[model samples]
Target: MLFDLARPLLFLLDAEVAHELVLPSARLAHRFGLSGLPGGPLPGRQVNAMGLAFPNPVGLAAGFDKNAAFLRLFAAFGFGFLEIGTVTPRPQPGNPKPRLFRIAAARALINRMGFNNCGIARFVENVRRARYDGILGINIGKNAATPIERAADDYVACMQAVYPLASYIAVNISSPNTKDLRELQRGTALEGLLDALGRERRSLARKHNRRVPIAVKIAPDLEDDAIPAIAERFLAHEVDAIIATNATVSRAGLAGLPHADEAGGLTGAPLRARATEVVRRLAAALQGAIPIIGVGGILSGADALERIDAGASLVQLYTGLVYRGPALVREAVAAIEPQAARMAA
Candidate 1:
């Protein structure tokens, strides 16, 4: 609506700068109470997956509210669940300023923002201060300075720190920005890492006497064989949930978009197809062994439904929200609510 109309002005600014601008503006709107959640009652359609009750199936993906800086404000934007951080044990300022780019013609973006986050301690502090009441999952990653061999240590440290705070924890082993992060998704690496984390989850649950689900976020660039192989591991390790994808390095679908040549993970309209296929493959392979949190290029209710039809238990958005603004969430919820109601009936 208004956001689309104002896009020309927003497009005038540098991509990263515009992204930085959105946060403060949203925060200000919060101060005036103009910051609001979706208008309609969400039907109390609570579903338990990964040991958490999500009010609905739509979620704000990990990168949007990194550092937990704005979950309270985001809760007002109509997402059923809000996942924040790719937080590492210590804070590091991602890649560099010009990292985020927009391909308006194709309705896409390319970013190599190497997990710039305000360390785990600050992330914990921020989450503690937020007033959000919905499901909050914290996404954890290893520090860039940490070698790929020792990455498990950073994940372990972050899990130990944010465990008590997160409703669930997501292990991000797929962000292409990191030099060898995706390597962790390999057979031996993924199994070893999850084994260690799984032990920690059990130990912490017993010690604190509280249970929380642990999910893995994966990349979209893999092949058919790769998808099922990963799914097999998830089931074997008893992972509670899987966020079907993170952004991809492939530009296969964005044939006409400008800036398509940029070297980074491709997200938005261009990514919708391949991402959903990944979800479908994973879902079929897992056979409901665990819930799948489908994310990639969801920009509409139809897009959301396609993922669900493909077997995604929940759907998430990132690049779509950026192109469409807060209204996108309301639209997606409105689009899905009727089907959800009919399913309930």
Candidate 2:
């Protein structure tokens, strides 16, 4: 009800401006003890994955709270888990202004906002201040200026900084906005990255006396032939989970829509099928050896279930939240609860 009232007004402003306004306002609402959604947290079936338990399988994907500044506010809205960042080793202004675009008609978004973030130092500080003890996943990415060859260093640095705080660590090598970053998803680059991160995790586990799970986020734009090999690499490297997709560079269905040709990744409804297919492919390749966190274009209860049917152990929302409001979280949990029960049975 509140979101419906505010949707039209929010839609009235520039996309990024509306985004900036919404976060703080929502945080304020949370601070006042107001439920940010129509109801408070939804009842969900517990899920055990990555050696951590999730209250539900519906999560807010990375990018929404990139800096970890609004963890409590989002938690109030009933996500089973929350993933924050794509934060780098250093702060950097993202792509030039007007980087985010909303296509109301298609219920889609296109963004090339390079991994603009307050660097890992400030990001850690923000997380520490939030004191949020939920099942949090901290996503890390290489600095824009970091040469592609040395991206592993950035990932290791971030993992070391957040390992104690994160329920899991998500390695983001798939955002199309980062130049050549996607290359890390392929061939020897993929091997080296997994190997490096694997070595680091072993050392960190011994140092911290805890084994934090590592989930690799991939792009949805890969050729069909590439997925199995990617899955193979993940399995061989012992990746705890695979985030089945990041945004896509493809503009398949939005041929005539506004902002359809934007250079950045295309997300929301336009990428739904492709993202699910990627999950399906990963599932086939992984054959249950590894769990999958399905995301990209999930906008409703049915979409969430579809990802689960395709073998996603969990589902996440980003663009869906933009279109459906916090209510979508409840809807997704409701949709998945029965299936979860059946599985448990």
Candidate 3:
């Protein structure tokens, strides 16, 4: 395939450099109407979640198109929906140069790119310029410099701006790269943040005349004892949905591998099982109270199905897309379709 030929060359460059190259080219390709995207789900793959009808349960996770730059490229790849950003109220340069790493042998990636993105002002502008018409979810986060106590203000500001632009707004309190961001996931902090967002959503709904569902993206690195209380908080707070995981801080399965010692979150094959386990536990605790968007290390059709089988209402791909390519999207659609059809029935 074309990507197969390009993979070797892409792998040869610095991970971030290759990424910087791919998106602009993809945007240009889409702009010219030149990409022959495979398109969306086959007949029976549709599944509704978070009050939206997904053409398929497969989606491109946030971070891939951090700036909302290539909806056309992804839509052509046939994603049921796409989540973009981890964008903040103000633009950030992220951590530092060479922040992205490749674990080629493990089919994984590790990144400490703190939420580097254009400010919400420009982010909304970019979303407004995109022409791809599928569902778009905007993932929001706090600026690195924001004091942990004041994080909600940043999230609230970003949420208010993105509410009209997003089909659903994902609050990312879990990514490990940002300083103390995960602390927001703790007991009172988590509860207070959710409560604040819940109140904001109510006001925004009245103002915009729409209640854009908000999903919290949690960390996979939670201690075994914490999952239940987290789930309880979600239910009590009436959070619309939960993205069971963000990339993990653990380097669990990559023993002695290259880039295995990187400082950022680990994602891909090593993360699949841990991520699926979170979905399983969340599903049990949630008891179907709210939907779960499972994402972490899906790399194949079977991997995608594993997340759903474990109770994720929907699944997303990021690291996998790097190792596999757009073909993986269609493969995921096919793999989940039967089970999805049964659920739909």
For model 3 the TM-score comes to: 0.95
Give a tens-digit lDDT track for model 1, residues 244-335.
Answer: 78988988867766778887898888888988999889888989889999998888879987988899888888998888887777666656
- For model 1, the local distance difference test gives 0.84
TM-score of each: 0.95, 0.96, 0.95
Candidate 2 on 202-243: residue-level lDDT in tens? 999999999999999999989999999888988889899999
Writing each residue's lDDT as its tens digit, candidate 3 over 1-345 gives 557667899999999999888777766766676555564443446778889998888988999988887776777777889999988999888888889999999999999998899989988888899766688899999999999999999999999999988999999999999899999988788888998999999999999999899899999999877888888987887788899789988888789988888899888888988999999999999898899999988999999999999999889999998999877887888788866544533
Q: Once model 2 is optimally superposed onto the true structure by TM-score, how far is the C-alpha of residue 98 displaced, in angstroms?
A: 0.5
Candidate number with the higher lDDT (1 or 2): 2
- Give the local distance difference test score of model 3: 0.87
TM-score pick, better of 1 and 3:
3
- Model 2, residue 170: displacement in angstroms? 0.3
Question: Any runs in candidate 3 off by more than 4 Å, and if so which?
Answer: 31-34, 39-44, 338-345
Cα TM-score of candidate 2: 0.96
Task: Go through the candidates in order and give each one's C-alpha lDDT.
Answer: 0.84, 0.90, 0.87
Candidates in descending lDDT order: 2, 3, 1
List clash counts for every candidate, in order: 2, 0, 0
Per-model C-alpha RMSD: 2.3, 2.5, 2.5
> Could you arrange the candidates by TM-score from highest to lowest?
2, 3, 1
